[model samples]
Target chain A: MDIKPIFKTLIRNPVGLVLIATQVALTLAIIVNSLFIINQRLDNISVKSGIDEDNTLMISFSSLSDSYNMENAIANDLAFLKSLPGVNSAMATNSLPLSNSGWSSGVSSQSDYKGVEIGSAFYFADETLVDTLGVDLIAGRSFRSEEISYYYLSDELEPPVCIVSADLALTLFPDLNNPEEVVGKKIWYGGVENPKFAEVIGVINDIKAPWRGWSEPIFNRVIYVPHKPIFGKFSRYVVRAENGQLDNLVKNIQTELSNFDDQRVIRPPRPFSDIREVFVRNDKGMATTLTIVIVLLLLINALGIIGLVSFWVTQRTKQIGTRRALGATKFDILTYFLTENLIITCIGVIIGSILAMALNNWLVTAFSLSKLPMSYLLGSALLLILMGMIAVCAPAMRAMNVQPAVATRSV
Target chain B: MLKMNGLSKVYRTHLVETHALREFSITVDEGEFVAVTGPSGSGKTTFLNIAGLLEEHTEGSYQLDGIELTGLSDRKRSALRNEKLGFIFQGFNLIPDLNLFDNVDVPLRYRGFSAKERKQRIETSLEQVGLASRMKHFPSELSGGQQQRVAIARALAGEPKLLLADEPTGNLDSNMARGVMELLESINANGTTIIMVTHDPELAARTRRNVHVIDGQVTDLRTVFNNDNVERTAETA
Candidate 1:
C-alpha cells in the first residue's frame, strides 16, 4: 500500500480527519476515567485492615425475645463459646471495625475546649478485647484486666479517663508534640446534658466500625471506651482461634450452645477479612460499572469509525474507479484506503493518548482517585489502535469491492 | 490493434431485460483511426466500454494488444486497460482535485514509474498538448478546449497501444472542438490506433474510416481520402 497518497488525501479533507479525532478523544476519555476508578478501588483493597483476619471468626446474633436477658445472655454465650475446644478467646462487642452503622460522639481534649466537632467510632470491650480483636498498640497501653471499666468516672469532680486514637489526639490538640503524652490528659464529651469529663487512660491505634463509618484516614480518628459504666448489650461475639481452625471452633461452639436455647441461632462464621469486604462492596460495584461503561464507549467509537470510513469509500468511488482504470490492481485499491484509515487512526491515537493523560488528571481531582498510572494510558492507547483496525476492516472491504466501471459513468 | 467477435451485453432488471449490444463484431488494425458514429442511446458507448475493459460483455471474444479480454480477472483487466489503452471522455473527465501535471502523472504512477521518471513523462505529455506552461493549473481553471487537451494528455502519458475517445468534442464550441479534433488527429498520425465515438457526422467524416451504427447494429462503413493535390486547392479557395 502506498501511504504517500493516502496521507495527502487525508490532509486535503480536514473534515474526515476531524471526525476520526472526535471518536478517538471520546474513547480515550472514558477509558482513562474507568482505569483511574479501578486503580483507586485496588488501592483501597490493599490497605491493611488492622485485624488478624485468618485466626478470627465474627459471629453476629440478635436477641429475639420480649424480655431479653441482655447481660446474662451475652456473658453466658461468651463463657460458653470461649470454653469450646480450639477457641483461643472470645470478646463481646457492639460493633466490629469496617462494619456499617454505629454511634459517634464529639471528642474534646479539655472539659471546656471550644472546637469544631470531631467524630469518632466508639468500641466497648473488656480487657481480653485487645488479644481477641488483634488491634495494634502504637502508644501508651491497653486497659489492664481489672482496671478496664473504672478508669473513667461520671462525676465532674473525679479525674477523667478515656483513650483517643493518634488521629484524634492530633485534631484535638494540633500543637501537641507527642501522641503518647496526650494519653494522660483529660477530655470531655456528652456536651450540655451529661457533660462528663474523662482522663485519657490508654491510646491504641484507631479502628473502623462498619456501622459507625470512619471518615477519610480511618486510623487517625477512633475513640475507645472500656466495657462498663454506661453500656448496652452487644449483638455480636467474635472468637479468636489459636490454631486457625475456624471451622472446628465454630462447630464446637455451636454444639456447646445447642442446649442453652433452641431459639437462639448461630449465624454462619466468617473471617474478619470477609466481614470487612462488605463495607467496601459499593466501591467494587462502582469499579465494575465503570468497566462496563468504558466497554460500551469503545463500541460506540468503533461504530463511528466504521460509519465514517463507509462514507469515505462511497465518496471516493469514482476516484477509485479512475485509479483502477489507470492501472491500480484490486490490491492497490484496497491498500489505498486501508493506509488512509490507518493514517487517520494513527493521528487519532496520538491525540487520544494526550487527551487520556489530561482526562486522567481531571478524573483524579473530581473523584479523589489516586494518580493515573502510566500502564493504564499505554494499555488504553493499544486498545484504541486495535479498535481502529476492527472498525476499518468492513470499510476497506467495501472500497476494494468497487468496480472500475463505476467511474466511467456519472458517479 | 483490437478485435471483437460476437460481442454481446445484456442488462437484467427485476421486470425487464435489455440488450445493449448483440453479436457485435469489429476489428481495427495498427495505426488506423476508426470513427464509430451512432445516435444517443446507441451501442457506441457500450462498445467503447467493452473495448476499454471498463465493463464486461455478457458473451464476447475480445482481443486487445493480443490478450484475450474474456475470462480474465478484474485485476488483470485493470492492468490491461492501464497498460494497453487510453481513454478520453466527452466531459473532459479530469480529476478535479489534481492539477494538470498530476492528472497526467496519475496513470504513470500506477505504472510504477520512479518519481524522476514520472515527472519527466508528465512534462513531455503536457508539452505535447501545448499546455506545458499551464501544467500546474487545475482543470477547472482551463477552457473547455484546454481541459480536453489535458484529458488527452492524461491518456497519452501512458503511451498505450490503443486510444479510446468517447465524443471527443461533444461538449465544446466549434472553434474549441476543431482544436481538440486536430490534436487527436495529430496524435493518431503519430501511429497510435484511435477509435473515437462522435455524434457529429462532419467530425466523423474527417477520420480515415467511419463506421455508422443504428440501434445496436452497424449500418454502414465509409472511408474518405482526398488527394493532397485537390485538398490544397480547396484550402486556397
Candidate 2:
C-alpha cells in the first residue's frame, strides 16, 4: 500500500483526521491507566492471607443476662466444637485474619526506644488458636494448659510470654540470620515509662495483618498472646472445619451453640471467606467500575473511527469511482482505507504513549500509584489498531461498491 | 484497435429495466481517431464506459486488441484496463489532493512500474502536456484548461493502446476547449488511437471519423469503412 499520497490527502483535509486521532489518543491514555489500576485492585483482592480462609469461621455474641458465666460457657463451646465430626480445631479469640477488625500495640527491641518504634497487631486466644487458624508454626512449642489464662482489658496486665510472627521476630532482632534464633529473645510492648517485656516463646511463619498491601512494615508483623479475652458479657470464637463442610458447620454451630445455656444468645457464625469479601469489597467495586470505563472508552473510540470514516466514504464517492476507473480493484480500495486508518492510528498511539507516561507520573505524584509498564502500552496500542481496522471495515466495504461509471456521470 | 458487435447495456430494477445501449455496433482500427457525438440520454457516455471497461455490456461481444472481454474476472478487467486502456473524464478527475506529477503517476503505479520508471513517465507525460514546470501544483491551483491537460497527461502516461475520453473538454471555455482539442489531435498524431465523446459539432468535424447516436443506438456513420481498416457485423447500426 502506498501511504505517501494518502498522507498528502489527509494533510490537505485534516479535520476528520485530527478529530479521530485526538479521540484515539485520549482513549489510549485513559484506558491504559484504568487497566493498570484495575489489575492492581484485582491483585490486592487475590493476595494470600496467612490462614485457612475457606475452612475457618468466626462468631461473636453478647450475653443479655447477668448470670452468664464467660469462663464456663467458652469451655463448653470449645468442647462441643472439637467433638463435631468435621471440626479440625476450635478456640475463642479477639480477631481473625483479613477480617478488617484488629487490635494493635507498640513493640521495640531497645529498652530506651522512645516512641512506638515497631508497631504490630495483637491476637488474643487460647493455646489452640494457631492450630485452629491452620497457620504453620515453624518454630514454636504449644502453650501448656497452665500457661494459658483469661485476660481482662481493664486490668492493663501484659502476658509474660508470647509467640511472634517471623517478620516481627526479624524486626525485633535484625542481626539474627535465622528467624528461629529470635524465638527466645526479649521483646517490650506498652508505653515508654512503664514498658513491659515478654519472652518470645515461639516464632510462627508470618500472619498477614488486616490491610491492603502486605509490603508495609506493620502488616505482617504480629504478636499472638495465649489468652482468651474475659470481657464479662460478650465474647468471640473461631472454629476450623474440614474442607467440604465449612458452610454447613457454620450453619449448625450457631444453632447448636445457642442451646448451651438459657442466658446464651448466639450470633450467626461467619465463614472467613465472607470476612475476606468484606475486606476487599471496595477493591472489587473499583475494579468492576474501571473495567466498565475501559469498555466505554474503547467503544467510543471505535465508533468515532467508524463515524468519521463513513463520512469520508460518503463524501468521496466521486473520488472512489474515479480511482476504480483508473484501474483500482475493490481490494485496492479496501487496502487504501485500511492503510490510511493504520497511519492515523500509529500517530495517535505514539502521542498516546507519551501522554500515558505523563499521566502515570502525575498518578504517582498525586495518588501514590506505581509506574505504568511498557507491555501495557504496546499491547493497548496493538489493540487499538486492531479495533480501528475492524471499525473501518464496513465503511471501506461501502466505498468499494461505488461503480466506475460515477466518474463519467454528471453529479 | 477495438470492436463491439450488437452490444447492449441494461439497467434493471424490480419495476423497470432500462436499456442504456441497444445493438450499438462500431469498429475502430489502429491509428484512427473517432468522435462519438449525441444528445443527452443518447448513450454516448454509456458506449464510452463499455469500451473503456468501466461498465459491463449486458449483451453481445466486445474485444480490445483481439482479446474477448466477456466473462473475464474483475481482476483481469482491472489489469486489462491498467495495461491497455486509459480514460479522461469531463470533471478533469485529477485527484484533488495530488499534484500534477503524482496525478499522472496514479495509473503507472497500477501498471506495476517501479518508482524510477513512474517518475520518468510522469515527467515525460507532463512535459508532453506543457505542464512539466508546474508538476508540483495541485489541480485547484490550475485553470480548467490546465487541469484538463493534466487529465490528458494522466491518460497518456500509461501509454495505453486505446485512449477513451468522456466529454474531456465539456467543462472548459471555448478557448480552453480549442486548446484541449489541439492537444488531443497532437496525441493522436503520435499514433495513439483516441475515441472521444463530444457535444460540439465543430470538434466532431475535426476528427478522422464521427459516429452519432440517439436513443441508445448508433444512427449515423461518416467514415468510409474499407474491409482493410474495419471489421464489423451486419447489425441495425
Candidate 3:
C-alpha cells in the first residue's frame, strides 16, 4: 500500500543491493552460455551424415606380414570375401565410412597451368567399389572393369583418367549448365615431368567422413584410381551384407579369414550411428563441461544471495523488531523481507540482462558461436527470482522471530 | 482508564535470577496525569515498559479500556499496544531516517487507516505540538525539544487511550524540557491519561499524582499541596 517507505528502506542498504547484483549477473552469464552450448551440440547432431550407412560393414587388415606377397594376398582376400554367403557387394579401400581418415592430392591442367587449382580426395578402389558402396552416379558412370589396364599408365608416364563427385564438379564450374560438360576436361596431377592427365569420367553424390563438417561442403574434391598390382599390407575390406545377416556375415568372414593369420585382430562391427557418435564425442564433452560450470555458478549465486539476506536480517534486527511491535504480523514481516529481496533481485536481473548481452557478443566473436537468445535471458531472470525467494527465506524467518522487546530497549 | 494489580517482573539467567518489579500496583483514571519518580535502576523503566505492553510481566494483571492483558498472548499484546497505548522515550525515539510527517504517520499506518486519514491525523497532531510547518524536516535537522515533540506527536497521532512517557525530556536543555512538559500537561488536560516517569522531582510535583518506586516496590503514593487531590499509603514494616 505504501511503497515509498519500502523503497526508502531499500536505498538505505547498499551491501544487500550489491550482493543481489552479483548473484544475478553470474546466473545470467552461465545460463546463457550453457544454453548456447546445448544448442550448438544439437545442431551438429542433426546435420546429415551424407552416405547410405545401413548396409555397410568395414573390416580392416592392416598388419599382413610383408613375407607374404601383399598385392596377391589383398587381391585374393577381396575375391574371397565377395564370394561368401550373404555378402552382396564389397570393396577394398584404405578406409570406410566414418573412419575420418582419407588421402588428399592437388590437381591442375597440363604444364604451367598452376594455381592452387583444385584439391581432390583420392580413393584407390577397384571398378566395382562405387557400386558396392551404393553411391549415386549423378553424371557420367562408374569406372569400367575392362579399362583397368589403361587405368594405370607407366610410372614415369601420364594417365589420363580419374573420377570426381558432383560437389567438386559444381565448385570447378559453377556457371556451367551441365555438370557433364567438364567430364572430359584434362586435369594434371603430380609434377609436370611425370604429370598424369585425369579425365573426370563420373560424378557421385557428396560423402562425409563426419569429422570434416567444418571443411566438407566447401571442398568436396576427390579423385579415384583403380587398385594397382603393387600394394602394401595396409588396406580394408568393406562389405554390404544382405539385409539382417550382418552378424552371421561377420562370423562367416571371420571364419573364412581364420586360415590367413593366427594373430589377426578383428574388432566387432560398430553401427553407423555409433561410429558417427564417436566423431561427435568431443561435442558431448564440451556440453557436459559447460553444464557443470553452469550448475556451479548457479549454486554460488544462490549462496551469495543467502549470505546477503542473512546479513541484511542481522543488520536490521532493531528495525524488524520495531516493525513487529507496530502491529505487523509474522506473515507481514516475512512478506516484507521477501518482497524487498524480490525488488533487489529484479533490479539486479535488469542490469545482468544488459551485462549478458555484452558478454554474449564477446563470446560469440571469440568462439564463433550463435548469437545469444532473448528467451534464455528472460528465462534465467525468472529463475533467479525464484532462487532469490528461496535465498531470502532463512533471513525472513529470522526477521519474523525477532521479539518486539528487543527494539523497545535503548540501543 | 489504566489499571495494574499485583504486577511483578522477574528476569532470569542461567546463573542468577533478579526481580525488576515486585507486586507493583497503580491506577490512573481518565483525564488524570500520573508521574512515577525514582532513582536510576529503581524499576521505573520496567514499570513504564510493562504498562506500555512493550515487555511481559512475570506476574500480575493489567487492564486498559476494560480489556484484560495478563492472559493475552504476545501478538494480542502488540495489537492492544497499537490500538490503545502510545509510547514516548527518553532518547526521543523518533526513527532517525523518517521525516517528522512520516514519523507521526507510522502508528496510523499500522492501524491500517486510509492514506488520507493518516495525513489528516499527522497534520493535526504535529499542529498540536507546534510542528505542523516542520513536517518535512528529518529528526536530526530539528532541535532536541523539536525531536521530542515529534516523538510525542507520533504517539499522539495514534489517539491512544493512554500515553506512556519514559523521561520524554531527559535529553533536552531546561527550556526544551519545560516546553515538552508543558505540551504533555496540555495533552493530558484534554482527557488523555498520561503516565510519565521522571527523575526531576519538580516535573513530578507538577503532575496530579506522584508515585515513588524504590527497590522494585512503590513506596509512596502522595498528592501534593498545589492540587485538591491528596492521598497517602505507607509500605508494610
Q: What is the TM-score of each candidate against the true structure?
A: 0.74, 0.94, 0.73
lDDT of 3 at A390: 88
The model with the greatest lDDT is 2
The true-versus-predicted C-alpha distance at residue A179 of model 3, in Å, is 19
Candidates' DockQ values?
A: 0.39, 0.71, 0.29
Docking level for model 3 = acceptable
For candidate 1, the iRMS in Å is: 1.8
**Each model's lDDT:** 0.75, 0.86, 0.74
Give the distance in Å from residue A369's predicted Cα in candidate 1 to where it truly belongs: 3.3
Sort every candidate by lDDT, greatest first.
2, 1, 3
State the fnat of candidate 1 relative to the true structure: 0.52
Which portion of correct inter-chain contacts appears in model 2? Answer: 0.66
Shift of residue B30 alpha carbon in model 2, Å:
1.6
Q: For residues B51-83, what per-residue lDDT tens digits would candidate 1 score against the true structure?
A: 889889999799988888788988788778888
Ranking by DockQ: 2, 1, 3
Per-residue alpha-carbon lDDT of candidate 3 for residues A176-219, written as tens digits (9 for 90 to 100): 67767768876677765556677778777765432453433333
lDDT of 2: 0.86
**lDDT tens readout by residue for model 2, A1-411:** 688988998898888888888888888898889889999999879867788888999887788878777888888878988988899999888887677777887789876665337888888867886679888788867566677888776867588888888988888787899877987777887768888888888877858776644435677888888788867788888998988989788778887777755577788888888888998899999999999988898899889999989998988999898888889888889999999999899888888888988999999889889899998898889989999999999999999888888888789
Quote model 2's TM-score: 0.94
Which has the greatest TM-score?
2
Deviation in Å, model 2, residue B122 alpha carbon: 1.3
Please identify model 3 stretches exceeding 4 Å from their true place.
A12-15, A42-59, A63-209, A215-232, A237-281, B12-16, B39-42, B71-75, B224-237
Native contacts present in each candidate (fraction): 0.52, 0.66, 0.27
